[model samples]
Target: MKIFEMLIPMTWEGLKVTMSVFAITLIVSLPLAIFVALLKGSKNKYIYKFTSAYIYVMRGTPLLLQLMFIFFGFHYIPVIGYAFTRYQAIYIAFILNYTAYFTEIIRGGINTIDIGQFEATKVLGMSKSFAFTRIILPQVMKNIIPSLGNEIITLVKDTSLVYILGVTDILKAAKSVSNTYSTFTPYIFVAFVYLGIIAIMTNILSSIESKFDYYR
Candidate 1:
């Protein structure tokens, strides 16, 4: 309680920034992942290859590097330079990084489905897209929920990475308080705040997972 009294005012603005990054990344990346996953299976070689390369670049590289390259490095290039604002760059970088990961996760879920189902759809003379979108995608959503929850948990901490861009997130806010007070109290406060967030998130995810349990 004393810690909150000391830190909450100073850190409120930073918390807002952190939550915004997490929310936007999750909102945009989840749906975009489904689309990208479909493209990864596209019959057109070019589309499939392009998606593979994009995912490779995004997941193969450090997310911090992705943030730096977008916000700082891209500014040196013509046309692309000066295109996105700092805020936009932050969202874009986070979204792209998470989308690649989610895409692969979804693809993994898709692969876990039995091939016999695909054969069933073919035997029924149903189109591949229909079966995929209707019969397959929902089950994939259920299968991937736990995986997605794990990623979301990671994203909460990963939001701290934005401090590297001088975004004044909670970590940055804590650093300022720490410097001014010449104490580690601020970091302690920040850690508690993060734990509180993760605690709530864990509860919500458990509830979500339980809702799908009957299907199993």
Candidate 2:
């Protein structure tokens, strides 16, 4: 009971760190992903190639490796190295990694949209922007909701990787308590904490998915 009391506040602190990373990553990445997806589909070959290369590099690497490189490796650079804090490094890595993923997911959703819809919009003499905002984007979002939800859930778990940088996320907090008390109960408690988070996210995502069911 004493250990459980101790675990509660430490785990809550760690959960705050995890939630900050997840929320910031999602909020920042979503718009960037939309922009990148559009760039990937642009008529300008240079823009298309650059965005494609970025996506390839980001998606090709393991996120854990990326986090390490950003947090550790960047410190070796001449001028920019000194600017990165641990949290900054983690946020940069998470945003960049998830942006590539969200871009690809959005691109796939865009591609799966029927070409005839674009033609119909053009026939109606609507501007391209209008058509996309009014007609195409809604359907694309509907198609991609499930994939996006999976990524969000993954992000929650991935927050644990911040421990690599000594960021004191939930797992790290639990480990700290476990070490101090010489008991495994902290780990068990943290496991339930994580499970509770996942369950809540699953429920919320399911509700959002239901809102899009009208698309079908």
Candidate 3:
């Protein structure tokens, strides 16, 4: 078979895996990020300590090691061993990793809101929680959209890391196709697929930024 023929099929297969992981990560991470950001910003000492340690551990570790730990390490445990599949393990690892990163981003957005705004909301008879939801978070969302978009684009490329757990993601698909055909054209095809997805993401993010331009 010609190299281009092998490239197309390989690229298609890999793109599926990459998109699946990327989608799942974004869905799971967004809410988790808000929760963690709140915890990290809380005044309670225990909450601060626990969330700080969690973020440190996640950020400090290599993502590949984290995936391997989740995929392989849990099997040695008592009951959960038989329950986790490679796909589930990979999903958990990606979600947790991205959640930590996004939490920091979100916390930055929250911090950018002035304390004066919160005080003014309180003076206006708004409860703290109500003020956060109605007044503060909306503006934070505007600030965060661009940074979050960057993370989403990065996730598209990082999905290739799933191959560490034997997941057949796009880069792995390219490798398989290359090995089958004994050529490098499969990688070129895979790169094009990545470029196309990233291009689409850029357009979507740019649209979002324009829509939220009042914050700027």
Identify the leading candidate in terms of lDDT: 2
- Whole-model lDDT per candidate: 0.89, 0.93, 0.87
**TM-scores, in order shown?**
0.91, 0.95, 0.92
RMSD of 1: 2.1
Between candidates 1 and 2, the one scoring higher on TM-score is: 2
Best of the candidates, TM-score: 2
* Clash pairs, model 3 backbone: 14-170
Instruction: Give the TM-score (vs. native) of candidate 1.
Output: 0.91
If both were scored by lDDT, which would come out higher, candidate 2 or candidate 3? 2
- Least lDDT summed over 10 consecutive residues: which range in candidate 2? 75-84
Error of 3 at 194 (Å): 0.6
lDDT (Cα, tens digit) per residue for candidate 3, span 8-81? 77677767888889998999999999899999988999999999998999999988999998888888878766
- Shift of residue 116 alpha carbon in model 1, Å: 2.3
TM-score of predicted structure 3? 0.92
